[model samples]
Target: MTADDTVNQPSIALNSEVSAKCNEVVEEYRAGTASKVDAILRLQSIIPRSDDTEDQFKSALQSYVGMLDSADQARASAAKRGEQHDRSSSKRPRSPPESDDEDISEKPAKRSIDESRLPWVIDELLHPIELPPSLRLTRESLQLWSSNPKQYKASLTNAARCPEFPDSEWSNIIESKPINLDIVFAGHYSTSFDNRRTEKLGELELTFGETKPSKRIESAGDWLIAWTKASEALQFAFPHRERELREYGSYVTQLFGAVHPSRHHRVLQYEKAIRRRVSARRDLSLTDFSRFADLHLLHIDSSGAVALDEDSRPQARPNRGGDSRKRPGKGVEACRRWNEGRCPVDAARCRYTHICSTCRSREHTAEQCTNRARAN
Candidate 1:
């Protein structure tokens, strides 16, 4: 055959091969063997090399996919309306009606199904495209996917394909809470100070010296700076101290309130600093650092036992007896330990009253004191 004839013959053979694949797909659909989406994907995989034929195949596949999508929507709508349709109503059977018993299945089974399918679905959705090296699947991302599967599936799937994706991070994501680090750190530090002060007081008394006065925390900003500095110092002196602080911080934050933006930023900075320091000594993997940096602090109470102002600074605890209408004699006596600046007891568990710092008396704070001038 001539050169022109040879070229034309291969074009004809390619068209025939494409036609055969299309026919096979049609047969699969007619036999109810493959789903519409599956059939379309199959056709996509076998598109001819010719641009014209490829364009035609894509156009036809697009139209077919659209029809499949519409049918899915109709099926979902019917299900929501409680309409019982025959399984054989469509060329491809709809998934069996989920039995109520499905909900009653063991928690482990349900969790297993989720854990297995989530990564696979994510992989399929985000194939050939991956997430940035810095980002990983966080608890927030998992929650978002779990809450709105249809809405966030695309994004989650993309994130799942990230090279830095932590497959084992799912467990952590499931268990982690959006903890308020500042409040947690505050409680931890408060308790630590109390313990240390008691020890120091005992030492001073034995030496016939007076106990040192407590350092008053003027504002939330000041408190945060002090706590951050202390944490840095502790972590510097004892390498394991960082992990302990994180554990305590996570526990406190989860128990008390949501993470404040300022506190969250500071914690991230602290973690980054630690990572930098560690990397200097030994090569740090992005995976390890991501795991270390994964502070699951999202979706918590806006306000908790510890309150914060709009500026994300911790608000001073309200005075226990600020109301002018209350009788002074009926007021509870303040805890002497608390007044001396460190209450060893848990704030909530403590039986004694929390006194206002501005006034020594439990009757009122300086803000509400009628005898403010006299006291001054």
Candidate 2:
């Protein structure tokens, strides 16, 4: 109607336009086509054209951005928790058999090594060894050794002749003594022999004959022990077919239940053990043995610690002695006492060179120097 009213009318129209734009942004956000950042940007653009004061615009923008940030953090935390739960669930061991249907008997029989001659072989090998009465082989130990006769034979023969433990002492230890599972599974402890008992057990699925109904293992431990015996039998019977043995070992795990994925290394160890044993028995020429010895020494010098690579092969690490060059030099001062004969000090605690000042030799101090003695 008047000059002031005319100016206010356009301001009212601009505020309505800004309000409409704000509402459009809110709808776009709700529909999920636009993100919270886009919504905030849209809201900020509207603030410049709106009727609101500068302070009010600033306050509103800060509040909205803070709310959006809090919501985003909450979503991220929930997603992280869900991922962790999924990882743990995946790692949990498979549940035990739900019914008798899952029992070992229900599985289809597969062709395996024949161990019928195991008893005869074991008896023939061990009968001549004059073991102390205390160390007489039990049925269980005999069964375990039957798996790897070559290793067991080597171990038993060596144990019988071990000079460190006399027959009388061995007899005393084993007399009325229960069979040591450690000895049974590992054979006798020897610094020279690398025990592959655990690895041998893992390869049981590939090595031994079909699981007999009579020997249906009731527990996982017993099942593992039986497999160890089977692995040994397999090794003894087929020493040369390593590639086939490895493929069969992997296939066996797929067919039969495995111990655990974490323990899969045990199966790999068996392969290494077999290779080492096979290498030992195969008569190599002096030159070949020398080459192997050199390679082994190189492996030792390469690294102090042993580790497997991606291919499950042992990787010889490069020597880490280079790090020693970067270390700080010793800051010890010369010992004044070591230069005098009267100074009573131990070599380790005395940080200085013990050379005599008069003779410039380490054997005696200045006071005890032969030149000084002669001059006096």
Candidate 3:
């Protein structure tokens, strides 16, 4: 044979031998004995004249076994993960019964302070001064708004309002009308009477059980003035409840008052302002379609053997410029967006409409199939 013929003959024999040996190793690996590497080495050693052919074949076989073992381990791990997921899913908290009666039965009784005695206590404390109608509240507001009605009433009376006087000037006042027991007990007030004078009056009243006629009535002019200003400021803050304003005001009173007495008024004011601003603004919610479209804005690099078309192309060759356009390996080529034997953009416009090439039918390429795509 000529030199070229002899070279060609050896190449052909070598290719055939390699193919057969690869097949043998694969079969052995599948059988779980004599490992892929051993089988391949045994095949190569049969041709002793070939230098390190056994070693080369063993290396390749090892690589193949590694890939197969990795895949098998992944599958087993996935199955184990799925089993754990199922167990966790079954362990979720069961929802409680939904009916109002069921909810009521399940809940422990609330510790409610006696609201029946609230008004009377309030009246006694604020004696001789008629409570403003603003101090009165509906049953729902009363129960829901304050844990302690007496304290709630006092805070409401002290809330910031127009014409706020500093705490300095305050005193007792003569009766403008019959004293409201509610205002006396639960409300804040000041009296201008001296302790000695008050004691003398008390002693006289108690001893005689009657008042002498023509007794001089001492005036609490400064005290009355201070009380008037303070009361006005307090009352303005706690305005008479209209239905719409009641809920917001009551909520403010309950939460802020209970948690922060000194800052309660300021907090309520700020929170109300914020709510107003929010209400004035528009609301928007993005749908799934819009969200998906937004992802396309991200940058992507596509350097591969496959072109925009699914057809495989020859590996990229470097240009004269010396910049290499690397051809994607088999593993890398697995991650591209396609559908129904076409790209995403093309599939959307195609007459057949997009379908999973791998799962739905045999005609389309598996690479372009939606159903065959594995989630990362």
Candidate 4:
């Protein structure tokens, strides 16, 4: 492989020995017997034990996962607070009570940059990509980059790579977050070369990319930089950004693919894919997003449905089977008609899965999901 080729390592499938261990780790995770990092470390290891396995796992996951349990607990607490506010508000009757339209109006409007513009992928949660990233791979530039100690060392770190290449670094190089080497080598930079920064940033564009890039300072990298700000990769510092980036990346990943994820179906399929790439591995690319114009991740199924074969003929089963040991991101969404007791189709012939609508697990229905019980 060429020196620059190291930045794009292909996914290495598990060998028989590693596969056996993978099964154990995945099983432990499904049974809740293993912490996410613990299960991750088990699969990541080529050997059964290592002095630094856990440390390395944490360091890698820290790139985007944040403090796993702590973040979950914080979200759980916020959910509780929202519930309490709702309950107390319901108990307080207004003089004549608000009309339905007024009530709906009081509900927060969709987050947007303005009244006229379509909802952007960037906001407080997401910054905007200003320039297209380095393009051309010019011979002179390549020679200079190869010789520079800083760039040579950067190839080993995640911050120098795309997607997970930190937004923080655009503002401050010293604060670039640490990411796993596996993720560092993942982005298909060649794919995104065609995606240009159409929007103008004037003088500010230079701050995000090389001066005069794209003959106008703005380019694809700058645009991606904007999208990256709202990305899930930034969730550790901006907790509210998580859902927005997930929805955005998940959309891009499944955009042109068959068996698109069910956004309105309330299944965990897309969410889990986002979690696997961004949450589990700190990978920012969503499933070959750059294949068309965005991100891609290893083992991340943009199809958001079960593959019965290589052609990805989607199965009719309920649940994309999202939590399988063989693939990290696959799941069948619950059949909306069946969930509503309106589908006349048999379970064996339904278009969607018969799994739990909330968690997407086959173990229980949405009514029986733990979150529902807890809320009750």
In model 1, which range of ten residues has the least summed lDDT?
A: 164-173
- Over 44-64, each residue of candidate 4 has an lDDT whose tens digit, in order, gives 443322353455333333322
lDDT, model 4: 0.38
TM-score for each of the candidates:
0.24, 0.19, 0.18, 0.19
In the predicted model 1, the residue pairs found to clash are 178-297, 178-298
For candidate 3, the C-alpha RMSD (Å) to the true structure equals 40.1
TM-score of 2: 0.19
Of 1 and 3, the candidate ahead on TM-score is 1
lDDT (CA) for every model shown?
0.42, 0.42, 0.36, 0.38
> At residue 247, what lDDT does model 4 achieve?
61
Q: What lDDT does candidate 4 reach at residue 119?
A: 18
lDDT of 2 at 201: 42
Query: Can you give the lDDT of residue 92 in candidate 1?
Result: 83
Error of 4 at 201 (Å): 32
The TM-score, computed over Cα atoms with residue i paired to residue i, of candidate 3 is 0.18
- Measured by TM-score, the strongest candidate is 1
